[model samples]
Target: MTVSALTRPGERDRLIVKLAELDWVFILALCLIAGAGGLMLFSIAGSSWTPWAINHVSRFLICLLMLIGLAMIDVRVWFALAYPIYGVGLLLLVAVELVGDTRLGAQRWLSIGGFSFQPSEIMKLGIVLALARLYHGVSAEKARLSWWLLVPALMIFLPVLLVAHQPDLGTAMLILMTGAAIVVLAGLSWKIIGAAVAAFLAIVPPFVMFVMHDYQRQRVLTFLDPESDPSGSGYHILQSMIALGSGGLLGKGYGLGSQSQLNFLPEKQTDFIFATLAEEFGFVGCVSVLILYAAVIFMALRTAYLSHSHFGRLAAAGTTATFTLYVLINGAMVMGLAPVVGVPMPMLSYGGTVMLTVMIGFGLVQSVRVHRYAEVTSGKGSFV
Candidate 1:
């Protein structure tokens, strides 16, 4: 069918048309990355599907179905519910603060009906959707330089402060970067961006020395000099570096990585899974996985570019930014280039919450592609 036919009144609304519009290539990329993750998990778990391997594969399948279901929903429904979703996420964050579970010394999880989850995960998507919705009705000039920017600023910081108080600095930083990306995409002035960067640089030292919790501050110090205490606070980074360096050009061979098999690499199935891949499959495997990630990012951004509605564009782009940050931060941490922030490699790491969050973001991206031609109104009564 031609572009004109796809845009006709009832044509795009057809379920078959929407499914056909879905980016199968992008979907294939996601499947490949998740499969690589499952492969790594299986290898690291003594080739058994009983532990992390099966759960990782099963979760991806479930999240993939959820992604497709969410993709079929109208983008306008997403726009209308944006604020409500964000509102609920914020309230949950507050609830977490008041009576959240304190596991591993972080009060970031909330339990309901015997199921526990980190509310911060919800904010990951909430902030993106809410900010995109806010920017949708505003003009470029106002978005660039105006007193009107305060609304978006508040929308971002309120959650950042709340999450930071939970002491989950990794997620707080992700939320902050994702929100900043949307603001810049919305045309915030360069002058403001530059000033903000300068201020952040100035604030970091003081924040580390005074504001950061002791463990958080120690992670930064350890990243700088992992050799200082190889078996102490720096064990995670030092062991990760060893795994990466030992991997060499090819690898030690599957199920033969000493670092992970000996239980030397910390969080081998979660945060440092990349290092496990590096050890077992070496540089070649790592590069192949990185290529897959790059493809996903490129295709997602292309969807944003193809979107006609401002909400669709910003929503897709903002979600892509969050995913990109996850990959970069996790990659750096694994290689000992950045502080260990516990940011998991999306889809590649065996974590249910992060995997679910990332796939849902992609679902939004696919929805944008499927409804790229649908008209979305601004503000009240917005619809297709």
Candidate 2:
């Protein structure tokens, strides 16, 4: 009682209370994965990364600060800003189409001064927030048979179609899945999900063969049999598989893999980071990485369930599924089980934009968990 009585009540108390309410288990898990990512990036970058590492470390610091700031904000702030944020994001996408940076045959980034950003990443955040707003008042009767579902779909679809126009299939698919997960979590029926899946499967074959770019179609066909063109279309997959299998049981140890050292594995620090982990740490390491991902996803789903408000719940769920898809696509691509779609491994990938956006998403979910019941007085309803 004496110790409790000595404490003062203020912002510090509010901060402490919020911290106490958070899911530390999930936070710790994410931190562990992030730390591992930094270490792996060091190895991948090697002697050529002195400046790159410093800049990336600075980016990580910035990401951490943004996370803290976001986590302390009320959940309703995101809802209030959702539509405007989405509108701004769409405008940026349009700007991207009109006057954007074209690199490696994709017009996905916009450069300002010395810095560049991908509008697709911003759109990912926008779609999640926007969809959460739409699903906030969903009920079984309304959710099952209402135009509300279409509203969210259209919100998501516009950006996805634009990203696909950028010819960035990976991001477009990720955004689509993120929106679909929100719809499903909003209590859309299995009948709907199943039918949607069936329609997608039926439609994809024709699009792949006729509409997709030549190299993109090659990626899909090569995944089915990587050895078919070891010198051409399948080179990346074959090399990655060899590197992964070469690691054997424990691993070849860090910074010692011939595949990466000899420059056989492409995009070693970015899209193919998991392969770097595999080639250095082997099966045990891969399992450890998978376990960390599973833990984060599990806690994220739990956070969604425990959230006090529908908006918070949907945001948490959609964000969790987005993370899951990021990990799955990257892992499968590295293992030669899926086509090379340029999906970056969460936390581990070397891109600053992807890293920052992912961390912000994490912070947003954490904020939702911590401040789920906080009162909103800025033109939105308050819990108090």
Candidate 3:
């Protein structure tokens, strides 16, 4: 159907029209990536779907349904709930700091009634929605260089500090970058951007040397030189590099990757799964998966660009930024180009939390596309 057809009175509000408006192509790309992940998990498990493969596929199916359901909701609803969602995520982060569980030496997860989740995951979406809502009201001139920028800055840093205090630096970085992406998209000044970049550069050395935990510092050091400790702190990166290199041009024909099958590669089902793919499928397979990722990114950014409302644009763009960061950080870490910050390749990695979080973000992106023509009220008034 054409755009003119949907402009008819009460036409766009129908469920059938909304469903038709959904981005089926975008969904197909996601399915391809998730399917590849399941294949690799099956391969690594000796061709059994018992452990990693089944769970990965099942969780993805559930999340895909959730994404479709969320897509049906009007973007105005998302705009209305933005602040409340952000406020709740902030409180949960505070709660995690006080009474959260410490897993693997990090105080990141909160358990309630035998259920546990990382509140930082909520902040991933919260920060995007919240910042988008804030910028939707501000004038471009004010957003560029005025002192009023501090408000958005505070909105961002508050969660960053809290999540960083949890010492889940990976999630914290993701949240920080996502928020920054929205601010830049909203027209922040180049001078300010340059200064902030310089400031970050100035602060990194001290932050690594003094603020980062011992293991965190060591990961950075290891990335700089993985061969220094092949059997210790650097083992994960070294093994990942070996797996990536041994895959050659066409790979070892699947399930025959010595690095992963022999248990040389670490975190095979989670953060290092990309290396597992590299080892079994080779460079060709890796590039194929990456093309799927590139398609998803392109479509998502196009949705943001096509949005009529500022909220829709920023929210969709911010979510895309988060997804892009996940792929880049995990890919770089697997290639030994960056520290192992425990960021998994979204949808492809074997973790429920990150998968759910990513799916939810895409849901919002789809919501934007479905309601791209809907008029969002100015932030000074009610959302409707």
Model 2, span 1-384: residue lDDT tens:
566555757656888888787777877787788777777777766744554455566677788778777888888878788878889999999999999999999899998898889989998888998888776755777776566667777888999999999989999999999998888888887877898999999999999999888889999999998889999989988889988999888889988877887789988878877888888999999899999999999988888887878888888888888999999998889998889999999877777888888888988888988876754442343444
Better of 2 and 3 by lDDT: 3
Candidate 3 off by > 4 Å: 1-13, 380-384
Measured with C-alpha atoms, the lDDT of residue 157 in candidate 1 is 96
Tens-digit lDDT string for candidate 3 (1-384):
889887866785687788999999999999999999999999999999979999999999999999999999889999999999999999999999889999878899889999999899999999999999898888989989999989999999999999988898898899889999999999999999999999999999999999999989999999898889989998999889999999998999889999888888889999999999998889999999999999999999999999999999999999999999999999999998889999999999998999999999999999999999988997543655
lDDT of 1 at 76: 89
Tell me each candidate's TM-score: 0.96, 0.92, 0.96
* Tens-digit lDDT track of model 1 for 1-384: 889987987875687778989999999999999999999999899888869999999999999999999999888888988999899999999999999999888899999999999989999999999999999999989999998888998999999999999998999999999999999999999999999999999999999999999999999999999889899999999999999999998899999999999999999999999999999889998999999999999999999999999999999999999999999999999988899999999999999999999999999999999999888889563664
Clashes of 2: 0
Candidate 1 — worst ten consecutive residues by lDDT sum?
Answer: 375-384
Candidate 3, run of 10 with poorest lDDT? 375-384
Candidates ranked by lDDT, best first?
1, 3, 2
Better of 1 and 2 by lDDT: 1
Clashing pairs in 2: none
For residue 116, model 3's alpha carbon misses the true position, in angstroms, by: 0.8
Clashes found in each candidate (C-alpha, N, C closer than 3 A): 0, 0, 0
